[model samples]
Target chain A: MTRRSGTAVLVAWLTLVWVGLWGSVTAANVLGGLAVALVLVRVLRPSPAGAPAVVSPPALLRFVLRFLVDLVVSSLQVARLAVGRRVELRSGIVSVQVPGASDTLLTVLADAITLTPGTLTVEVDASTATLYVHALDVGEGPEGVQRLRASLREQARAVVRAMGTAEARSHPTPLGRTGDRRREGQP
Target chain B: MRDVLSAVLMLTGVALALVAALGLVRFPDVFSRMHAATKPSTLGLLLITVGAAVRMREGGDAVALLLVAAFQFVTGPVAAHMIGRAAYRSGAGAQAGLVVDELADVSAPPA
Candidate 1:
C-alpha cells in the first residue's frame, strides 16, 4: 500500500480507536476500541494518493464553526415549531441542482439538512448533481417554490463551502409541468 | 440546581421518546412519522446523555457517556439516510409534500 493510502487508513483506524477509548476507561472499552479499529482499518483499506497532505487548519476551523451555527439555528427553529401554534404550514419538496461539488460536500449537505428542523433530504442524484429537499412552512403559490429553492440553494452552498469546496455553478435541473404542480384552483 | 437540571433533562428525553413512538404509531405515512421520530429522538438522546455524563462523578463512566454521544453523532444521519432512501425507492414517499425528483436518470435499470 502506498504511504498516502496507508495514512488515510491509519487516520480512520485511529479515529475509531480514539472514539472507543474516549467512550470509557474500562478495560473492556479499550479492548473494544482496539477491535473496532482493526476491523475498520481492514474494511476501509484506503488507496494511497500522490497528493501531499494539505493541512488547512483555517478551513477545518471554518467547517466546525459552520456546523455549530447550523446546529444552533436549526435547533431553535425546530423548537419554535414544536412549541408554537400551527399556522397552516405550506410544505413542499424542491430539487436543487448542485454542480461541481464533491461527494464529500454532497454527503455533508444531506446530513446538515437532515439534522436541521423542518427539512429533510429525500434524495441525491450524483449523475445530475441534484438534491431533493422536503421543506416545511414554504409559503403559498409559485413565489413559495422559488423561495424554497433559494433557501435550499443557500444552505447547500454553505455546506459545500464549509467543506472547503468551490461554489457549485451548476444550472437548475429542469422539471416538467409536474415541477410546480400546485395551482390556485387545485384542491 | 444540578439535580434539578438532571431531572428535567431526563423527563424531557423520556417525553420526546414517547412522542416519537406515538408519531411512529399514529402518523399515516412513513416520511412524516420518520420526520417526527428522528429529530426529537436525537436531541432527546443527546441531552439525556449529556445530563448523565455531567452527573457521573467518575472518569470512566463519563468517558463512556461521551463515547455514546459521539456514536450517535455519526450513526444518526446514516440511519436516517438509509431509511429515507428505502422509503423513496419502495414508493412509500409518493405522497410526500412538494418534491421535484429528477433521479429518473440514476434510477434507470442497470445495463
Candidate 2:
C-alpha cells in the first residue's frame, strides 16, 4: 500500500478506538478526537501525481463545510419525514462512475455519500470504479438520477483532489442508464 | 436514580430490537431489511451495553458489556455493507425507479 493509504488506515483505526472508548474517559475522548483529526489533516497530504495535478486546500475545506451543513439539514429533513407523513420519499438505487483509479478515492467517495442523510451507499464495484447509492427521495424521472450523479461527481472530484491523486482522472462513466430494469428471476 | 436509568435503557433497547426485527420482516427489499436490522439493532445493543455498564453490580459484567458494545459497533456496518453488496450483485434491485446504477458496465459473470 502507498504511504497515504497506510496513513488512512491508521487514522481510521484511531477514529474507531476513540469512538469505542468515548464515554469511558471524557478527557481521553476529547483529546483523542482532536489528535485523530489532526493526524487525518496531515496524513491526507497531497501528492502531485494525483489526477488533475492541482490539489486545492480551499476546495477541500469548502466541501467539508458543505458536507457538514448538508448533514445538519438532512438530519432535520429525515426527522420531519419520520414525524410527518411519508411525503414524496422515493427510495431507489443509483449508480455512479468515478474517474480515479485509486482505491482511496473510491472509498472516500462511498463514505462521503453514505455520510449524507438522504443517501446510503449500497454497493461499490472497485474493479470498474462504479458506485451504487440508495436514495431516500428522488424527483420525477431522470432528474433525481442526474442530481445524484452531479453531487457524487462533485464530491468525488473534491475528495480525489484532497487525497492528492489528480492524475487519475479518466473518462466520465455514464451514471445509470434508463430501461435497464431488472426483475427477479431474469438471470 | 441508577436503577431508573438502567430500567429505561433496558426497555428502550428491547423495544428497539423488536422494532428492528419487525422492520426486517416488513421491508420490501433486502437492502432495506438489512438497514432495519443493522442500524437500529446496533443502537439497541449500544444502549443495552451502556445500561449494563451503569448498572454493573460487578466489574466482570462491565468489562463484558464494553467488549460486546465495541464488537457490535465495529461489525455492524461491515455486515450491512456485505449484505447490501450481495443483494445488488445478485441483480435483485428495482430499476427505473430513481438514481442510475453503473454496475451495468461490468457484465455479470456466469454462475
Q: Which DockQ value does candidate 2 get?
A: 0.16
Q: Chain B alone: TM-score in each candidate?
A: 0.80, 0.82
| Residue pairs in candidate 1 whose N, alpha carbon or C atoms collide under 3 angstroms | A5-A48, A23-B63, A23-B64, A93-B98
lDDT of 1 by residue, B1-111 (tens): 878887888787776666556656654456656666666677678778877877888766766786787778777876887887777777676665433343333442122
lDDT of each candidate versus the true structure: 0.61, 0.60
> Residue by residue across A116-153, what tens digits does model 2's lDDT show?
55666777767656677777665667776677657766
Candidate with top TM-score is: 1
lDDT of 1 by residue, A54-73 (tens): 23467557766766566555
Evaluate model 1: give its TM-score: 0.71
Model 2 scores a TM of 0.54
Task: Report per-candidate DockQ.
Answer: 0.30, 0.16
- Model 1: runs farther than 4 Å from truth? A1-43, A47-89, A166-187, B1-5, B22-28, B97-111
